[model samples]
Target: MADGTVKRQIAAKVRQAFAPLRLEVVDDSERHRGHSGYREGGESHFRLTVVSDVFSGKRRVERHRLVNSVLAEELAGPVHALNITALAPEEDSA
Candidate 1:
């Protein structure tokens, strides 16, 4: 799928999986331009920040693993890199 489509799917999956109180998915592929795994259409890189109750008791690795598992299809396809910031709702003072 294309960049926009991938972005939409990522957002949809995360929203569905976590029911996050706050979530942001950023496509950072454009900045990678001609870098390896960077496609011309720019959907290969992403940064996701999520705040949810589900992350409350989880370690950082577990949080990342959960997100990675949920987005496995995307990673197996057009997505090349992902940076995730996972936080519990109680941890979010802002």
Candidate 2:
């Protein structure tokens, strides 16, 4: 996968896996320009904020693990850093 499409691919995979009510996948690659793991064309670093019922009753780490499991391939490949904020729908109201 090319750098430009990784975020879209991630959003699709997360939607498939968790069915999040709200999902935002932001590519922060530009912020790390010229740093290690920073690809010249961007899409190296990303931050995901996901709200879903699938996260209900799960611990924070577990939620992260859930996302990590889904994105294992991306993490192991072109993705450099993934900063995730996974939240249950209920928690979002808090």
Per-residue error for 10 in candidate 2, Å, reads 0.3
Give a tens-digit lDDT track for model 2, residues 1-94: 3446998889999999999999999899889988899988778899999999999999999999999999999999989999999999988853
TM-score of each: 0.93, 0.92
**How many steric clashes between backbone atoms does each model show?**
0, 0
For each candidate in the order shown, give its overall lDDT on alpha carbons.
0.93, 0.91
What are the per-residue Cα lDDT tens digits for candidate 1 across 1-41? 45389999999999999999999989999888888899887
Candidate 1 accuracy as TM-score: 0.93
Write down the RMSD of candidate 1 (Cα, Å).
1.3
lDDT of model 1 at position 8:
93
